[model samples]
Target: MRQSQNGGKRVLIVGGAGYLGSILSRKLLSNGFKVKVLDVLMYGREPIEEMLAHDAFELVEGDMRNISTLVKAIERVDQVVNLAAIVGDPACTLKPADTIETNFLANRALAEACKYNQINRFVYASTCSVYGMMEGDEKLTEESSLNPVSLYARSKVQAEEGILSLEDENFSPTILRMSTLYGYSPRMRFDLVVNTMTKNAVIDKKIFVHGGGKQWRPLLNVEDAAEAYMRVLQEPLKNVKGQTFNVGSEEQNYQILDIAKAVKESVPNAKLIVEGEEKDLRNYFVSFSKIEKTLEFKAVKQLKDSIFRIKKAIEDNRFSNINDPKYYNVEIG
Candidate 1:
């Protein structure tokens, strides 16, 4: 039987200092679980320093590549949310070897550690990018044949298969293939499409639409993405255990130009520029009904709202160091 919410159950967040991991750590703490953050602290702890004051929160500064560190982190934790990785296509492209070692091999090490430690509930944060270069408007589901175009997506697909294949009577690993996330974060990243356009509008007073902006992509606010992890933590084991759920909202799909226009509506003075002879290969609308039906989870933030938040952040000088390498992936660094 699955363990219920008790006072002593520990939750270990593998990359708790990164964008999504930072948010999930706080949410888990609020829900009465002891939170242990195991991250390299690549960007620093300013994002989650406040959480350290909580009696139930612990931080382990280490890399996921170190199997000894991973084994130590999982020691007594009831659940493990694996968010450690060299994220994004450009980042993976820059360091292909490191990406594979960290994203795939490290995850395999973590799964083995989890199995050895008897920590069953393993939640993997994957990407919708696994359904690379889709044709037409068909919404890609969990069963959809994966067609990964980028090295990063391929790494995630390999890791997902490796982790899920480890499922047994004792260990129940759950995979969440998250859509393109946008919105504010303590460790904010402006490289994402929505956030980048919003920042461009607020700072440069113009929005650039690449390749005429016709590429379709689904987006989810970062907060909603964090909430999906919480829902998985609370749901019945049978419903979520050993399952892969695509995290997103059906209504959130929009073309790149549409998102830019939404930003223009929010920032009226923002100009629109379309350029670039090259077109991006990734374009697809994802189906999120699987998670919605099983866990009753739905994204709460809209694209309009995300634009407003980002615009306001820029207006208030919250991101004065906009070009810092902290928010950029390996490629941009």
Candidate 2:
């Protein structure tokens, strides 16, 4: 294969058939990196079905928690990106044991395996929800104290700590505390705030705003999130190694009510409703300066753009059934 910007480096993405992983794997392969995906295919193979034919793409169907499977997958791979997890608040709550085992324990095991295999460069996918909630208008940074409110966030926090603890001179690990993601993916997710709102506006013709719609959330497109991973992997190790960066644009932060309004604006016939005064405890925005300055990474997709894109995809019948169990993590996971 002709060389691309990534210099044909082989990188293994654990759980690479999930929503974010599927997108990231495609991005890596398109940019000249040989991509090896290790996934149990919990959501099924359709997300990666088209890519199976790509010369640079290789799929290893196995569980990341199995030591033997992980060890074999890491062979001949230069770096590893861990994106394997139960992945959302409700989903994690439903399967607490699996969440802990996959998100936290499996992550630690993955780190140990990478270290043992001498794969020094590792990028771990973490979530900005680790901040939980912040007082006033404060925008939480990587240095801010964590107050994870959900089992999902807590598991990710524990995994981040566990992986970072394994960092040494020979093992370079970088943690990316990503903002809540939206936009369309092969493995679409309607569980997220933005996507849920957009789906509601498109299907139900109404968007519900709970907790007085005052909670703050930072949103990033699935594509932008994938780009951030590519940037980190392509950059010099000294710049990203042993570092934690929140991945999102400063301009993408929006109040819950405002997100509903944006979706309504995209689908003009949709009505917006406010339900209950009880706020969502997991309310926080994040700072992306660390990544912007260090890796020169900035999310290019706007919230309105994603809303419109999703709306168009829905209108185009890209998904025969928008209510599929596979589109929702809580439903299928």
Candidate 3:
């Protein structure tokens, strides 16, 4: 592919300091893409601090709620990936207004700005939580009805609609309904299920299972999630435009207990403490056939590899304090 500007590919990732974005920016920059990250630095700059020295990487510290910020960020860019938002259910519940503005409103505005700027490829990071909890045993596809059980999922549902509403011949907006992300990222987070369990297995010697450990959750490694985005960025417009693909593998779906057990197996000595009550309502086995069939994209990273990455990061003392607020999305102001 020909580079967009300065003989290199120029792409803007709105939330490029988050868990997945941190890994993604590195991948793009390594491939000679002139990467620009626009974030409020809610987490901190350390996730991407190493990238600051790269000649092809640029950081625009700003919020996605600002229209002018997005307009300036996307100007003359080949692709725009929107990973910015109040990500996760608890985080959204804690800040409903902020979630609405960022997840739904600003997301819609960003898509419009991309279209207006004549940027054809727009990737909106959605979640499979949109299919909140299905009653059936069969796996849900992109065509399945979205039963968003939380404010986080609901906001993404609306954002998906609003962005797709702007889709036309000129603007190719692709929505990736991503599965639950786990594994190590430069912008590390212990809030995710696999990451948390693995960390606890190594450090605390016990992993807490909030639910009965039977709730189904589809898993996708952060690296694999990044790869899915990269594939969409490279695919032909007709193949991906105005389409929604579940970014995960059906084989990766595992019950909560299964995930915890995987951690126990890896750590060997950690015990799984299963609680009687299950609170978080999301449970669904996702079908990633659409993305695999269309773009030839399937999650390549193994589930165990993800667990090992988090475990190794912890053993290496990557985070000064695991309980630090910077590691969570909701803890920030």
Candidate 4:
């Protein structure tokens, strides 16, 4: 049985120093969990360096691909949240070999390790991009056929299958198919749609929309994404075991043009320019009803709120250099 929201519930958050992971680490620590972050910190250590002072926080700086590292990291862990990956389409394409090793093979090994170590809950972070380029107005559910067009999405699909195959009475794995994340994190990213658009509008004075910006995308606040993981961890094994939940509200889905307009609204003088064919093959809306129905998880942050929040962050210079390679997964990968 799970600890049921008690203190001293130790968690190993793989890639916990990355964008979304950084946000989650802070949350878990605040909630009284002994948070262990196993990350290469590929970007840098500054994102989570402050947490080093917290008694409840521990940072295991190592590669997830290393079995010895996994063995050490999972020690005394009650839950495992796998958030490490190549992250986006371009990053996977840029480093195909690395993507395969990290996203698929390494994840499979991690899930197996969790099972071996008797870790009660293993939550895997997946993407809504797995529902790539669906037809019509259908909001893709967990049961919907996946049409992954990019190597990134393909790796997640393969990894999800691999992780789920290990689920049994001892090991419970819950998959979260997260929407495209926005808003700010301690370890920030401007590569995502809202962040990118808001950054461009503020810094570049212009916003670029590709393929006329008509693709449907579900957006989730980075903070809300963190909350979903917390909720899943608190729930009993029987409720979330071997389950996959889409983690964004249905109303949060929007066309790219709508995203651009929001950025324009936030950044007063920004000009919007549409260009090119939809070079990116990803276009799909997701349904969050399953998570809402099962765990009462509904994303509270709105798209406009994310846009303005990012805009405010930039104006305050909370993050520096919009073109910094650190902000871009593909460039850094």
Candidate 5:
């Protein structure tokens, strides 16, 4: 594996209309990469439509399941970032079959296409939810055993394994296990915990805490998550290729109550409500040491800053129709 000369490389970003994909596409374009975004655009392309005007940007409206579309999208691309997926636990639960097909099987198809086309780098967006539950004080690393709890996590694990298996002398596959992403996006989602809490606080002056809000988890700002990908794209291939790196910071780990406090700190008028006897079984704190040591990467955004941004966005009506089903992970239609 050889280091890629960052500038002038062509990148194909699958699911470019989605949250992380849209941000990553913009970051790559700003860094001078020729960008082609392949998305089904299920929600809309408004997030990236502006980039289409750029000479370096191209859009392919298609599905990953379609091999013909994947082939065409992969053409003349130096690297591929697979971000196309059903996304989130609720979303995957609502569309279990589609989740399996898109998150797992489609990835298999993408791997085959990349291998056949001899693509330079393949970066897969996986999640830390693969570490479902932790025993004692153990902090999970890339080497930690996976105990995936949801269909979404399971599918990501499958995709990660399959993509790595396809890696050889010609193909370099990098898996990024990202922490729970928050913060504003061009395609903003109120479905995420922080955003949802902040929205409820701003509109109704109350935020609900489910199951006493005790479970622990790591969080990362969307911009920081996108930055991790850029680092992989710019770094030496031998350092990142065929390796799985956890992308996040230990400083962001917090209990559910801690997040609620953070939201209240941003919105002092907000009240707290505890409801439901059911606890979300997924709980774990992850270590980001591997990526930090290897890539010299560290998350720059803090939780307070994310809280402030979401609060301001909500207060200023930046996210109008926050109740829209399209912005939520649950499929209303």
Candidate 6:
């Protein structure tokens, strides 16, 4: 039987030092789950540095692609949350080979390891980017056809297919197709849509709306994303196992121009600049009915809240230098 309470359970959060992982790790620890993070720490360890003091938290500094390292990380873990990936399109495009190796191949291997080790509850992080381009104001759902337009999205689709194929009575995996994430994190990233706009508005007093500013995106706060994961982890295995949830609220969806305008509203003096003509092909908004109906999960934070919160963080000089390459995934790649 699976552990009902978080107190004694062990969870291995692969890539636990990344933006979303950083928040999730802290939440799991506070709720009494022992978290063992296996990450290359390619960015740095500062995101999880404070976690080292907690006796329940453990960090295994290594690459997920390394089979030996993966095996070692899952030694006694009860559940696994796989979040390691070459996150953005630009980053994945810059390094296609690394992207496939890390995002798809390594993820399959980890799921296989978990399956064989009797870790039935595996939560995989997918993205709504799988719905590449939707026309006619249609809202894509979990059952919608995937039209991945980039290597990053394609890798996630393939990984989801491969991981779900491993599901059975003894090994059930849940896929959380997360929306574009924003807001502050210990390992801050300015490359995402909302964060980038907010950061540019705060620093340069300008917000750029590329691709004609009409592309639609479903935004989710980092804290809310972590809550979705925790909800799945806490729910009974029968409820979440072998399920794919689009993790975001319906009302949070907005177009590029609107997002830029919101950031401009927060910054007040920032100028909104429109550039190019529909360069980006990704423009699909998603439906969150499935997750809401099943897990009773609804994203609490709104885009305006995220914009103001991030703006305040920037105004307070929370980040030493937002221009640092570490803040942009593509730049790091």
After superposition, which runs of candidate 4 have C-alpha atoms over 4 Å from their true positions? 1-4
* Superposed Cα RMSD, model 3: 2.4
Report the C-alpha lDDT of model 3 over 6-49, residue by residue, as the tens digit. Answer: 34768899899989999999988876778999999987999999
The sequence of per-residue lDDT tens digits that candidate 4 reaches over residues 137-238 is 777999999999999999999999999999888999999999999998888888888998898899989999999898899998999999999999888779
TM-score of each: 0.96, 0.96, 0.95, 0.96, 0.96, 0.97
Poorest 10 consecutive residues by lDDT, candidate 3? 1-10
**Candidate 1: pairs in clash:** none
| Candidate 6 wrongly placed segments (more than 4 Å) | 1-4
* Candidate 4 lDDT: 0.90
lDDT of 2 by residue, 189-299 (tens): 888999999988899899999899888888899999999998888888888889999999999888889999989988999889998986579789778888888888888
Alpha carbon lDDT of each predicted model: 0.88, 0.89, 0.88, 0.90, 0.88, 0.91
For candidate 2, give the lDDT. 0.89
**What's the C-alpha lDDT at position 192 in model 6?**
92
**Error in Å for residue 10 of model 2:** 0.4
Residue by residue across 112-176, what tens digits does model 5's lDDT show? 88888888699999999999988778899999999999999999999898888898998999999
C-alpha RMSD for every candidate: 1.8, 2.3, 2.4, 1.8, 1.8, 1.8
**Backbone clashes in model 2, listed as residue pairs:** none
Error of 6 at 292 (Å): 0.8
Question: Candidate 5: where is the Cα deviation over 4 Å?
Answer: 1-5
- For residue 196, what is the lDDT in candidate 6? 89
User: Which candidate achieves the best lDDT against the true structure?
Assistant: 6
Candidate 1 segments whose C-alpha is farther than 4 A from its true place: 1-8, 331-333
By summed lDDT, the worst window of 10 consecutive residues in model 4 runs over 1-10
